[model samples]
Target: MHCYIVEYRAYAREHLDGRWPTYSRLVSLGKAIAPAGPVELWVLQSGARPGSDYTLLASKMTSTPIDAFDVLPVECPRDNVRETPPIDILITRYCSMNSKAELIALARRMVKRRPLGRLEFVGPAE
Candidate 1:
């Protein structure tokens, strides 16, 4: 399976109708990754205490175009340390994972050689 990870800060504001705000950059990234095949988009919440585990807010399978009105500006962390890249990939399907821990473990292994960034891809071993 191919996976793409993007960071989002949900604390900054309340999500409207439980939908995650998508950004222009995020949509572009999704387009770049969609050609490979079905992809899992892991939404990792930022601002967790250093050394603490990451919070997986949501997971979606993106392979659709997003409405213009649904797009929002890039989200910035509360500390203002850095700006999170905007991601607005339309969720075509919802991914049901066995457990959060399982998902995280897979993410950890995939990203071990390449640290997570704004938008990271974890494909089959090269």
Candidate 2:
């Protein structure tokens, strides 16, 4: 896996909630973030280097997404029909913290710094 530092504009399209994405939408979004995978999605800013932030965000995975929830876990059998949630189902989800305000500020900063335009791919060099 590699680490990517992505600004909001480059990642805006991949932020899918529950809507079904059209093929063309997927194609365009895929092109925009060609080399970066979803390693770290920063909704808010710390103004720190991506190195410090990546560790903290990755820590979220240590706790399961369903922890403390009242929902029951079910197992699916191959012979039985797999069930899916209806499109209109209302399920609670978490958004990244202080995302709106941070994104707005980021846009302003990017205008001056072109920080959003910079995409860094750091890993074992080929």
Candidate 3:
């Protein structure tokens, strides 16, 4: 199966409740090849805030966009209502920047965008 990479903002109901996205490589020794499972990693945007800026990154199978993510629920206090579907995340790598243009550029490189393999819903890479 082809691997899909996507970048988007992920956040919790509140700033402090936020958790960094993460990645994991599923193991299947039964397979003839070792490490046959996919590798997941987050490509966060620079200067994005916890609950404001869009700085989250995700990757998964080439199915639906959500399939590309390893999401985790955002924990909150009892008074705070839990998010319905929760958020998809693993271990995320955060970049620091001053403008949205810079963030888009970095995201483009992370996904290895090609003329034939453009992202499903992200903005233009040019």
Give the best candidate by lDDT: 3
What RMSD does each model have against the real structure?
A: 17.5, 19.7, 16.7
Query: Cα miss at 56, model 1 (Å)?
Result: 6.6
Tens digits of per-residue lDDT, candidate 1, 1-126, equal 323333333533344345553321221212112222333434343333442223222123544642211111122223323334545764332233354454544443342232223322334322
For residues 22-119, write the lDDT of model 2, one tens digit per residue.
21110001111112222222222323443222111111122343121111112222333334465587543322323444433332332232122232
* Model 3 clash number: 11
Candidate order, TM-score descending: 3, 1, 2
CA shift at 61, candidate 3, in angstroms?
Answer: 10
Candidate 2 residue pairs that clash: none
lDDT of each: 0.32, 0.26, 0.34
**Worst ten in a row by lDDT for model 1:** 24-33
lDDT value, candidate 2, whole model:
0.26
Off by over 4 Å in 1: 1-91, 116-126
What is the clash count for each candidate, in the order shown?
4, 0, 11
